[model samples]
Target: PISAAAFGVAGPIVNGVAKITNLSWTIDQIEVAHALDLAADKVQLLNDLEAMATAVPFLLPEDVQTLNTAEPVAQRPIAVVAPGTGLGEAFLTWNGRRYVAFPSEGGHADFAPGDSLQLRLLNYLAPQYGHVSVERVCSGIGIPNLYAFLRDEKIAEEPQWLREMMDQVDDIVPVIIQHAFDKAAAVPICVQTMEMFAHILAAEAGNMALKLLSRGGVYLGGGLPPRILPMLQAPRFMELFYGKGRFAQLMAQIPVYIILNQRTGLLGAGYAALALDESL
Candidate 1:
């Protein structure tokens, strides 16, 4: 709104509650109000993730997940996905015409990798990670460790140049992914690591969808998917997603979507507050 204000496209900033979730500082709410010249009660406290959750119902069909069928929603569940520091999972239950969404701390849940390769990954990661949680392995901050593991496993061979490139950087997951997609064959190891990581992600997403019985299909939301749309489109995701053996038939009926927009959470939060206000 700052730019809008300068252009006379918007009015003066009004009193509205804003929750600063990512801050470590103890927000003296009253102090912030005085500094911003706003009323104390005008500001509120909430997690940004929570705000993202609130946007669920307000999302356009494209913004949310829709299953394989053209028919209306049958007996099943709805799932929400948001990837930032870690992946966030949420679900909504429909009771007749009314629906309710609930939050979860699933990101902190244990990393359950399927098959022996992933088992090796967990074993390799466990010595350092002790108990591996999803966030510790799958996030922007955590992927470097995975890449290092790949280097050791000979899953992705990095030349002196790339090796030096990675050594200097703390997070190399993006580069690793790029290399995998671009030079997976030329760099056999990067290919394996990237493919394995893709499998792991698909496995995790499938686990979420199945456990939630996400009959509404699965929606992918996060910073990485938008950046890696083509890679995300790889058959590896679909292969792992439907690798549930006998249940594979059931899963195939589910469709998956990648959300490309970044403001989804903000939109969800605003919708939530507005609804809450109206209800009040």
Candidate 2:
């Protein structure tokens, strides 16, 4: 028999109600509790990223690919930065005997360029997107923006074949990523776009780590990270991540891992449900 229920949703939760972002669905804890024959308090809704953060303590050796080998500080805050359709951020902090997950909208925070090129990228985007957030150059949707910037700036030439291919697709991210990995084909523009993407992602991950001082580790979750594993493994990514001046040494000690398990969010939701049951 089900004693409690928990859900990891993609939107903010207010007063036990969640309105899913980019979707036309509204979830109410009272409705869910009534339908499940449980008390309202027994049902809980968490932002999707928070659920992923909750599962960090439960991740197995095979569930992730290590990016850094630094030792984790016991029970210190752990941060999660995921770049999927959009950038999602979350963290877990020790709460007495357990780690409690918290969601963040840090991805929507103002973007600060880490270098000259990025400053140029920002200037190029600001006129088009009045308030360019980190998500503007770090997520799946952001790939095209990077690609277009490089192309228009003449930093890289966009091949006619790739342009034709992009024209045929409704979503250009996969096309860009696929060509970026095509070593034999050597798509310069795609490669440049992906490199920029990795740099921005690494910088943002470092920003999150610094903000929370997540000595427990930083986990990279989301659809994009897994697909671009090679790029993240490249030395350039770590270079950008560790470019925090005096804090560079500190960032190096915060272990980083890329989540490979697709069911992490589900596992986290189950953990949350179990916690709910235990409290009752």
Best by lDDT: 2
Model 2 over residues 1-280: C-alpha lDDT tens digits? 7999999999999988999998999999899999999998888998899889899999999999999779899989999999999999999999999999999899999989988988999999999999999999999878899999999999899888888988998999999998899878858888889989999999999999999999999999999999989999999888888889999999999999999998899999989999999656
What candidate 1 gets wrong by more than 4 Å, as runs, is 1-23, 27-46, 61-76, 95-99, 183-189
Weakest lDDT window of 10 consecutive positions for candidate 1: 1-10
Candidates' TM-scores? 0.76, 0.98
Quick one: best TM-score, which candidate?
2
Model 1 C-alpha lDDT per residue in residues 33-139, reported as the tens digit of each score? 56656455544333445555555556676664432343325545766665555767666677676455566777778998788877777888898868898776666
Clashing pairs in 2: none
After TM-score superposition, the amount by which residue 166's alpha carbon in candidate 1 deviates from its true location, in angstroms, is 2.3
lDDT by candidate, in order shown:
0.62, 0.92
TM-score of 2: 0.98
